[model samples]
Target chain A: MSVLDSRRGGGNGNNDDLASLEAGLDALETHLDTRASRWRKLLSATWPPVLAIVGLLGVWELIYRSGVKPTYALPSPADVGLVLRDQLSDGTLLEAMGTSLTRGGLGFLAALAIGTPLGLLIARVRPIRRGIGPLVSGLQSLPSIAWVPAAIIFFGIGDAAIYAVVLLGATPSIANGMVSGIDQIPPLYQRVGKVLGARGLSAARHVLLPAALPGYVGGLRQGWAFSWRSLMAAELIVHSPELGQGLGQLLDFGRSNNDMSLVFAGILGILVVGIAVELCVFAPLERRVLRRRGLLVARS
Target chain B: MTVLEEQRVTRSTGAVSLRGLTKRFGDGPNVLEDVSLDVAEGEFVCLLGASGCGKSTLLNLVAGLDRPSAGSVHVPGGRAALMFQEPALLPWLTATQNVELALRLRGVGKSERRVRSNELLELVRLSGAGGKRVHELSGGMRQRVAMARALAQDSHVLLMDEPFAALDAITRDVLHEELVRIRESQQLTVLFVTHNVREAVRLGDRVVLLSSRPGRVAKEYPVGIAHPRRIESPEVARLSVEITDDLRTEIRRHGAH
Candidate 1:
C-alpha cells in the first residue's frame, strides 16, 4: 500500500524517490504531440488552391474555344493574358497597382485607427454598447457599394471621396469584430485575471486584448475586403486629374471603349489583388495567432 | 479574541477569515449564506458540498474576486492564489509564460523571472514542459502546470476549486498525491474544494460540507489519517462512506422541500 502511495510524509527528504515515481507517472500518462512539421504543412495548404485554379482555367479555356459568345463579346484566357503581358511591359500595371494599393492602404489604416478604440469602448463600456451595438451590427451588413454615392455627395470627385467610401464601408466590421471577441472570452479567464491582481488597464491590456485578438483579426480581414471594394466602386464613379488612374478607372475606360479583353484584364487585376492580400497578409497573420494558441487544426 | 488565538496568529501570519460571508447574484436567490470559517496558516481544509452548493462562490469571496452580500472575508495577506476547476491557463502563452505572468504581475525583476519560473516548474515536476503550450499538455499536465502557475504568485494561501475533478480516476489520484506533496513541501495553507468523498478524506486535515440552495456549512469532519493516503485504502474508504452519507442527507433535504 505504501509502495503505491506516491506522496511521502513531510521531513522524509525523499524528493529523489518522489521524482522517480512522478517520472513513472509521466511515462504512463498520455503525452501531447511534440511538434508539427512546417513543409508538409505548407504543401498540404498549397496544393488544393493550386489545383482549383488549374481546374478553373481548364473550364474557362474550353468555353472560350467553343465560340460560346463569338470571341469579341468575351475574350479567351490567352487574349486576357496577352493584355496582361502588354500592361506589365509598359509599366501601366505597376502604376495602377500603386494607385489602388495606396488608397486601399490609407483607407484600411483609417478604419483600423478609428474602429479599434470604438470596438474596445463598445465591448467594455455598457452605456456605449447599449447605444451603438445594434447600429454597428446593422452597418456591418450594409454593402460597401451603398456608401459610394453618399461619399461622392459628401466629398465630391477626389481621393477624399474614395477614402471616405472605404472608411464608411469597413469601420463597423472592424469594431464589431472586437466586440464579439471580447464577448466570447471565457468568464473563467476574467476571474483568474482578477485573482492575479490584474485590474483596470492591466486587465484589459494583458487579458482582454490578447484574448480578443483572433476575433479582432477576423474583423480586420473583413474590413480590408470592404475597404478595397469600396475604393474601386468610388474610383469607377468619380474621375479627377489629381486622383490618378487606378484598376477601377482602367476597367471603366475599357467599358467605354468596348474592349472586352481590357475589361477582362481589369477584372483579373481586382480578383488577383484581393486573393493576394488575403493570402500574403491576413491569412498568415490569422494562422499565426491560431497556431500559437493551438486553436488551428493541422491539415493533412 | 482569545490570547491563544492571537499568539497563534502572530506566530504564522497568513490566514483566511470568513465571518458571516454571504453572496447573491443580482436579484436571484442567495448563492451562499452566512458562511463562516477560518483556515489557519499552513492548514489544509477541504470544502465538500453537493451540486449548486456555491462552494465556488465561497472561494470567489475568499479570494476577493467578489463581494459578499453580507458579512466579511479577511485575509492576513492581501493576495491569495485561486485556481479553477479548469486549468484556465491562457492558451496564448507557453506553460512557462503562463507561470511568468503571475510573477510579472507581482513585479518580479525581469532577469530573475526566468530562474524563478523554472524553479516553480521543477517544483511541480513539469521541468521540460515549460516550453509547451497549454494545448500541448494533457489534462493532468495542464493541472500540474496550473499548480506551478498558482505557486508562482507566492501566496501562502492557495484556493483550489475542484482542480482535479475533470481528470481520469487514475490521473486525479496521481494529482491528489502531487497536491499533497507540494503542499507539504511549500507549507501552503490550502482550501481545496471537491465533491469527491474519498478525495476529501484522502487530502484534507479537515472536511467541511455545504448544504445546497443558498449554500451554508452543514457539517464538518476531521480526518486524522497519516499522509501518503491511498485513495482506495480501507481507512480512507471507510471515512468517505461516513462523509458521503452525511452529504447525501444534506442534499436530500433540498429534494424533500
Candidate 2:
C-alpha cells in the first residue's frame, strides 16, 4: 500500500493547509521584538548614575564647609576640579592617562593569551585540572597588590616588574572564568557536537569555546579590572625616574609635594578611568554577548 | 547458523542493526540487556518504552556517543544524525549558521555551505529564518532549525530522542505531519524513541515496545494502517491501547518483582 495514499489525492490542498496552519501557530506563539525609543532608554539609564554622582559631590562639599578636616588633608571638590582642569590644560593628566592605559591594554592582552589556554587545559584535562584547579582559585583570591614587592625584587622596578604584577593579578581570574564557563556548558551541546562529527580540537574550537563565551567575557572583564589594579599598585610602589608618570605616580607625587588637591585629582582620574573602561569597553561587550543569546531580557 | 554469523548477516542487510546490545554504568544494574533490533533502508521505526528502558542509551550507542557494554551496534549508514529532546542548537549562532556548522564539520566548502544550509532550511520550511538567532525563534521554529541541522549531516539514518515531547499538543501534531512529509521527501531511515504510545502509532511503520530496567525487546507491532492516519483515528487508537496495556503490564512486572 502507498504511504501517501491519502496525500496523493489532495496533496496540494493539504500542504497549503499545513503551511498556513504552521504559519498561524508560529505567528501566535513567537515573540515580537518590541523596544522603547532609544532616547528614552538612554535617558532612563543615565539619570540615576548622574544623580548619584551629584549627591556624592554635594556631600563632599558639605563636609568641606563643615571643616571636618584641614584643607591640606581633605581638599574640597572644587579644589580637586581646578587641579584636574589645570593638569588637563598643561597635558600632564593626558600623558599620565595615556601611559597607564597603554600598560593596562598590553597587560590585559598578555593575560588573555596566557589565561585562555591555561583555562582550556584545566577545564578539559582531568589530571591537570586536579593538579592546578585549586591553585588557580587560590591565586584569584590572594591580593594582587601583595605581588608588587616580589615582582619588583624579581624584575627590578621597571615596566617588566609592573607587567609581572599585572599578569599575576589577572591571569588566575581569566583562567578560573574559562574553567567555570566550560563547566557550565550543557552536556547536550557536547553530544550534539559529537554527533555532528566535531572531534578533539574541532570540538573545543567550535562548540566548547563558543558555548562558554558569556562566562569567558565575564572573566575578561574581571581580568581587565585586576590588570588595572595591579598596575596602579606597582606604579605606587616601584617609582623611579625612568618608570614614567602614571596615575599612581601622580598620586605619589602629590603626597611628596603635600598638594591635597592634586592627590584628590589623581584619585578622581583613577576612578574615572576604571569606570570609563567598564562603561565603554566591557559593559557593551557583555551586553552584546548576553543579548545575542537572549540571556538579557528587555527592560520593558 | 551460529548466533554471530546470523548477527553478521542481519547487520549487513539492514541500514541499522543492533545485535545483543547491553549497557551498564559503573557496577549498576544493566540499563539494557541483550536487546537486538534492526531498521531496513528507508524504514521508519519507533522505539516505544517506559522510562529507564535505556531507549536513549540505545540511540547514543548507534550514534557512537556511547559504547555498548556487551554487544555490537552496526549502522551500515555511517554516523547517524541524532536529535535530542531539546533543540540543542548553538545559542551563539543564527539558525543558518547552526546548520552551516554541521555542513562545515562534514567538510563542505565555505561557498557551498551557505547554499546547502539555505536549501536545508527551505526544506524544513524555514527559508526566511536563517538570519534569526536561536532565542529569537519560537520553540517550534528552533526545533525545525535543529531538524535542518540534522539533515545537513547528510546521513541516511536519523535518530530522534522524543524530539517533540516538550511541545504543546497542537504544535506536536503539526510537527508530526511535517516529519511525515520530510521523511517521505528525503527517503531517510528514522529510529525514533518515545514513551507516548499514540505518537509511536501515529509516526512509525513499526512500533517496537521495550521492557524497562534491563531493557529487553518485549514485542514488535507492524502498523499496517495507511498513511495520513489521524492521531484520533480508530486504527491508531486501537493499536495505542494495545501497546499501552502491554507497557503497563511490563511496568507491573517490575513492581511485582
Candidate 3:
C-alpha cells in the first residue's frame, strides 16, 4: 500500500491526516540540529580534556592536604590560592601581568618584522637562502635563554636587556618558520603563479605569503614562546627601578623572600597569560585561516 | 622537400611553433628529435604516443616550462595555459576562487573577477560549485574546475598533458564530449597529449604519433571526422585501429633492443 493509504486509521480521516503530517514533520526535522543538541555533541568531544584537567587539580589538592613537603618548601594549594587572591585584590598581579604581556607582544612583533623579509629572501633568492639557511636553522636550535647573560652585559640590566634577549630568542624561530612555509608550497603553485602573471614582489604578496600562512603562523607561535621565555629570564637577572614590576620580578621577589606560595602564584599567573594570548589571539587567527581555506571541521 | 617547407611556412603563422626540437639529459640519447611542428590558430591537435614517448616533454617545451636542447621554440601569443594529468587545484581555494586567481593575476578588476570566474565555472558545467573546495570535488569535477581556471586566462592556446587519463571510462567519455563542446564554442586551440588512440582520434583534428625512446614523430593522421563524431563510428574506429597498430610497431621496435 502507498504511504498515504497505510497511514489512514480505521474510519478516521482526522487521525490519518495527523499521522501523515507527523511523518512529514519527522522527515523535515531530519539532519536539523537544535542548539542544545549541538552543545551536547561538543561536550562529548571536549569532556576528555576537561576531565584530565580536573584530575590534575584533584591531585594537586590531595598532595597539598597530605603535606608532601614542608609549607615553607612548597606551600599548600590553598596557600598559593590565598597569595593569588591577595595579589589580585591589591591589583599588583594584574599590573605585573600587563607589563610582561606588553613586553612579550612587542618583542614578538619586532621579531616578525625582521624575520618575514629574511624568510622571503631565503625562500626566493638562491644565494641568500643558501648562505643564511644554515645560519637561521642554527640560531633556531640555539637556546634563547642562553642570550640572557650576554644581553645583560651588552644592554646594562634593564628593559633594554629584556627586549634584546627577547629579540634574539624570537627572531630565529620566525625566520625558520617562514623558510619552512615557503619550502612546503607546491612547485605547481609557483608555475601557476607565474603563468597568471604573478612575479617579483607582487607574486610574493599575493601567492607565496597566503600559501605559506599556516607555516608562518606556526613560526609566530614559536617566536612568542621564545620572546616570553627570554624576557622572563632577562627580568629575573636584571633588576632596575626604571623597569616596572613584572611577572618575572614578582617571581624573583617570591624567591628572595622565601615565599613559596607567592612563587607558585607567580608561576600560575605566567601560565595563565601565555595560554590566554594563544587562545584569544593566535588560536583564533590560525582557526580563521584554516576555516577560510575550508580546512576546519566541526568537532561534532 | 617543398611540401615540408610549405608545412614549416604554415606552422610559422601559428601561436606556438617548434623547429627541429630535440632534448636530452646529459649524454643520453635525445628524448625528442627533429620535432618540428606548428600549431595553427584554433587548431585542435593531439600528440598520441605510449609512455616514454616524450609527449609531455614536447608540451612542456611549448609551454616554456622547459627548454629544448636543440632547435627553437616560440610562443608568438604570450604565455600558454597548461593543464596536467592532475587537476593541480590549489587546496586553499574554492573552485570559483581558483579561477578568479588567474583573472586577478591577469589584472582583472575585483568586481569583474567574480563575474568572470562564475562564468568560467558555468562554462565547465560546474555552476553553483564555485564555493566547493578543491579536495571536496571529484576527480572529473576537479579537472573541469582546472579547465575553468585555464580558460579564465583567456589564453590563445591550451596545452593539455593526459588531462583525462586518470578518470574512469564513463567520466572520461563525458569529459571528452564536454571538451569538444567547449572547444567548438570557444574556438580554442588545443595541443592534447595522450596514449589513448581512440581519444586521440576522437578529439583531434590532427594526431601526431611519436615513437618510444629517442622519440620522434612516427606518423601523422589527419582526422577528417566532423565535430560530435561518435566513438562507434566507422571512421573513428578505423583511425584508432591504424594508430594503435603504428604505436604497437613502435613499442615492439623498442623491445628488440
- What DockQ do the predictions score, one after another? 0.43, 0.44, 0.12
Q: What is the lDDT ranking, best to worst? A: 2, 1, 3
Candidate 2 wrong stretches, greater than 4 Å: A1-10, B1-13
Q: Pick the candidate with the highest DockQ.
A: 2
How well is each residue in A178-229 modelled by candidate 2, as lDDT tens digits? 9999999999899889899999989988999999999999999999999999
* lDDT for each residue of candidate 1 in A113-172, tens digit (9 for 90 to 100): 999999999998999999998999999888777887878788888888888888998899
Give candidate 1 regions above 4 Å deviation. Answer: A1-17, A24-48, B1-14, B26-29
Give one digit per residue, the lDDT tens place, for model 3 in B94-209: 88889998998888999989888877876676776688777567777889899998888888789999999998776787678667656755657889999888999988888999
- Among residues 3 or more apart in sequence or in different chains, the pairs in candidate 3 whose N, CA or C atoms overlap within 3 Å are none
Q: How are the candidates ranked when ordered by TM-score, highest leading?
A: 2, 1, 3
Judging by DockQ, tell me the better candidate of 1 and 3: 1
Interface root-mean-square deviation, candidate 2: 3.9
Question: How high is the TM-score of chain A in each model?
Answer: 0.91, 0.95, 0.83
| iRMS (Å) per candidate | 5.1, 3.9, 16.6
Task: Mark the regions of model 3 whose C-alpha exceeds 4 Å error after superposition.
Answer: A1-38, A294-300, B1-15, B74-76, B232-235
lDDT of 3 by residue, A44-155 (tens): 8688989998888789888877987877986667778888999999999999999999998998899999998898888878999889889998998787778888887887
